[model samples]
Target: MEKNEKYLRAERKVRALKGFYIHLIVFILVNIGLFFIDLIFSHDGMWFYYPLFGWGIGLIAHGISVLGFGRLFDEDWEKKKIEEFMNKD
Candidate 1:
């Protein structure tokens, strides 16, 4: 039982770490893309700034998806698991 619990915890931690790294990579890529788009297009006044604004919006959406939605689901799952473990003990 203890070994199984340890294994489950390890697996969850590994998955969370993998997701964190993936999000980091995606965030970096989006920012880089925004920079290039701004550099190439915004030749006039602040037209390119539009894309930056869009990027900001995208970041907020991503944050809600990742931190809010993801964490909410994870917390529910963790809570259920904890309840089950406690019941078993």
Candidate 2:
């Protein structure tokens, strides 16, 4: 049972990491296309930065969640919080 749980957790982490990678790939490809489109059609103004920066923020957040920042809120933290609240009651 314990080993199975560990496997499940590891699988979930891998899945999250894979999702982040896919998101990154799409962001890069789409932005590259968008940049060229803007350059060809809208030469008078540079507007690619808008979607680039906006989607960039989301991509950053996703990367952080799958990479390191998410560790701060894992099962241990949840259990500790639950224990703390239980003790209060």
Candidate 3:
């Protein structure tokens, strides 16, 4: 029961991490393409930064969701660490 829950949580984490990586890669590739297009087509001003900034912000949030946001170090992990330290003594 608990083992199954742990495994499910691990799988969810792996899936989220993989999705974030894929999103990052796509963001990079698509932004590169957009940059080139903007360079060749738009002649008045550099408007590429708009999408770059917006999408970059989204990418940052995605990274935070996967890596930060304290999801990884939730209560379960904290309790495990506490048990480990208590057992060490």
Candidate 4:
């Protein structure tokens, strides 16, 4: 029973880590796409600055969603960490 629980916990951790990586990749892709779009539309220079500014804002929002917020709770990764620590004794 204990071994099965441990395996399940590890599986959950892997899934959560995978989710984090996916979000990171999405963030990078969105930024890159926006940069290219800005480069193309900014032929007039300052006009494209707004999009770049918006991109910065979007980045911040994404960071908050992925890192600052309680996304860790959704993954239950911290709970597993605590359990492992408690079992160390």
Q: Work out the TM-score per prediction.
A: 0.51, 0.93, 0.76, 0.50
Ten residues in sequence with the least summed lDDT for candidate 1: 44-53
- Find the 10 residues in a row with the least total lDDT in model 2: 62-71
Q: How many clashes in candidate 1?
A: 0
User: With candidate 1 superimposed using the best TM-score fit, by how many Å does residue 43's alpha carbon deviate from the native?
Assistant: 2.5
For all predictions, the C-alpha RMSD in Å is: 5.9, 1.2, 5.2, 7.2
Candidate 4, pairs of clashing residues: none
Arrange candidates by TM-score, highest first: which order? 2, 3, 1, 4
Off by over 4 Å in 3: 70-89
| Colliding pairs, model 3 | none
For residues 10-79, write the lDDT of model 3, one tens digit per residue.
9988999999999999999998998999999999978888999999999999899789985877768899
Error of 1 at 2 (Å): 1.3
> Which window of 10 residues has the lowest lDDT sum in candidate 3?
69-78
- Computed on alpha carbons, the lDDT of every model, listed in order, comes to 0.70, 0.95, 0.90, 0.68
Best candidate, TM-score-wise?
2
Off by over 4 Å in 1: 45-89
Q: What is the lDDT of residue 6 in candidate 3?
A: 90
lDDT of 3 at 47: 85
Decide which is better by TM-score, 2 or 4: 2
- After the best TM-score superposition of candidate 3, give how far the Cα of residue 2 lies from its true spot, in angstroms: 2.0
Which one wins on lDDT?
Answer: 2
Cα lDDT of candidate 3 equals 0.90
lDDT tens per residue, model 4, 3-63: 9988996787667567767766876677677668877876766444565567668666656
| Candidate 1: C-alpha lDDT | 0.70
Better of 1 and 3 by TM-score: 3
